[model samples]
Target: MRKAMIVWGGWPGHDPDLCASMIRGWLKAEGFEVRIETTTAAFADPAIFDLSLIIPIYTMSKIEKAEALNLCAAVSSGVGLAGHHGGMCDAFRDSVDYQFLCGGQWVAHPGNIIDYRVDLTRPDDPIMKGLKSFEHRSEQYYMHVDPANEVLATTTFTGEHAPWIEGVVMPVVWKKRYGTGRVFYSSLGHRAYELDVPEIRTLMTRGMLWAARE
Candidate 1:
């Protein structure tokens, strides 16, 4: 069976545990041998680094250097990495190594929790194949994105407080190639309910499958 391990915990504000459980259930239904290791020690062992994918949902903490290096090597060797919002972008704000691996950092979000629209850009992408434009009432992330990342979804600043920021499109969802490893990240998921959204769930499912070193 396909095997995967997710290391999650930290910053309950992001609800990492709850989000991890949801992703676990989806992967389980998809026939993967899923495991959860909610400990910092797990991130450092080389033995645990050979899974089809490695998911880190922690935010703003230093993982053991050994473990962090192992994960970086795994991704460079073609293991896929996937996460959303702070789980990936806000994870290690001070660690350039972490930012390099994640492709970008979360900068400023104008409307933290305002009505926003996520426009599907990569219509041909498998993750967006059946998706139409989606709308949600949540924090619309405005990231200083990596030019290397291929954006799949985006939102424009149409709010009154965003005029100056207008025309500066923000990426809502993106996919990129890191060395031999594939990476996927979405600016959604500020809350558990965001993950519960059918559109978000669908996007994440396809993204996970695509990023799993297939």
Candidate 2:
């Protein structure tokens, strides 16, 4: 069976523990042998090299240099990495290497918890296939993303929230590569209950499968 690990814990505001439990159930339903860890030390364990995927649910936390290096090296060596919202993008602000592996960093959510729309930019992509643009009510993430990311979905910012970025189209979902590894991320899911949104749940689970090592 394919193996996956979820290392969760950081800000209580994001409910990392609750979110991790939800994702663990999703992975189990998909036939993965899932493991859960509560600290960054799990990242440095050499055993991580044997896993097929790593999902980091940590937001605004610190990672030791060694732990960060091991985690990045594992992904670079072909293990997949996938995550959503601040759990992934807002993690380890001090670790540039970790940020590099993630392909993007969360900067701001202009009008926190507001209504927005997510548009599928590459609807033909397997991760996005069968999905349509949908109305969403959550934090609309404005991120600093890698230009090389194969963007699959996007959202447009209206000046009402942040006037300077009005009309700016931001990547809502994207996939990229770190060495031979697949990296996938979505700017959705601010809270655990947001997964109740079918589109968010579908894309997140599909993206995990897409990022997994074959």
Candidate 3:
């Protein structure tokens, strides 16, 4: 069985525990030997490098130097990493290395919790195959993303909330490589219940499986 670790804990607003539980169920159902840890210290373990995938659901938290370095090294060595929303993108705000690995960082969410559309950009990609544009009533993330990312889905700003960004298209889902490792992220799921949306749930699950190098 493939080995995977989900290290969660940071802001309680994202409901890290609930997110981890949902992911745990998915990973186990897919035949992975999954472990869940509530601390960033788990990233420092040498064994982390041996895992198939790492999911960090930590938002706006601090990561020690050693732990950050170890986590980066593991992903660089081809251990896949996958996550979503502020938990992954906004995590370790001071750690540029982590942000570099993630390919993006959450900067702002215009209109906070409101309805928006997530348009599929690469429907042919396996991770996005069979998925269609969907409507979501949540935070519309405006991120500073790495140009190198292979964007798979996007959202356009209507300017209703933020005038300057009106009509601007922003990436909502993307995948990239950090060294030989696969990295996948989505700017969705501000609330745990959002994962219940069929399309959102399917996309996240498929993205994690893809990042696992499966």
Candidate 4:
């Protein structure tokens, strides 16, 4: 069976474990073997690079290069990588190379928790097929992006968060090709209950499969 490995842990504020559990169930239902490890130490193994897909559920702080490179090597060789919100973007903020690989970095999401709408820029993409623009009440991330991302979906702000920036458009969902592999990321996940809803889960799960190089 193909494997889905989840590395979750950081500030509990992101509800890493809860989100990890939700992802595990989603992967299981899809018939993939799941592994959950709550530390950066899990990245210590070169063998993990052999796994089919990797899900980083943690909002990283400090990361070790040896472990981080293992991931880069794996994805460069076609192992898939995917994550949502701070778990992937905010992760390793101190490391520019990691940010380059993930394709974005979290800046200030003004007003903290706010209600926003996410629009599907490419409705036919498997990750966003059948979904429409939907409103959610949670933390809306404002990210600084890398140039290479192929944005599949976007969300607009109406000058509420940062009044200085009017009608700001943000890439809520995107994919990038790293060497022979594919990388997928969504900025939607902030709270655990977001997954309990069907539309959001559908967007996320399909993105997972897409990132798995499937």
What would the TM-score be for candidate 4 when compared with the true structure?
0.96
Model 4, position 137: C-alpha lDDT score: 76
Model 3 clash count equals 0
TM-scores for candidates 1 onward, in order: 0.94, 0.98, 0.98, 0.96
Model 2: residues with Cα > 4 Å off, grouped in runs:
none
State model 4's lDDT: 0.84
**Cα-based lDDT at residue 23, candidate 2:** 93
lDDT of 1 by residue, 90-188 (tens): 886766766778777887777567898889999889899988998888877777678999899998888566778877678889988888998888878
Give the C-alpha miss distance for residue 90 in model 2, angstroms.
0.1
lDDT of 4 by residue, 1-214 (tens): 8987999999778888999999999999998999999888777677776788899877857778877877788888888889988998988878776777788998978788888888888998777878888888777788899778999888787887679877989898899988887888988778788777777788889988988855
What C-alpha lDDT do the candidate models reach, one value each?
0.82, 0.94, 0.94, 0.84
Clashing pairs in 3: none
* Model 1 lDDT-worst window of ten: 40-49
- RMSD for all candidates, in order, please: 1.5, 0.7, 0.7, 1.2
Whole-model lDDT, candidate 1? 0.82
lDDT of 2: 0.94
Clashing pairs in 2: none
lDDT of 3: 0.94
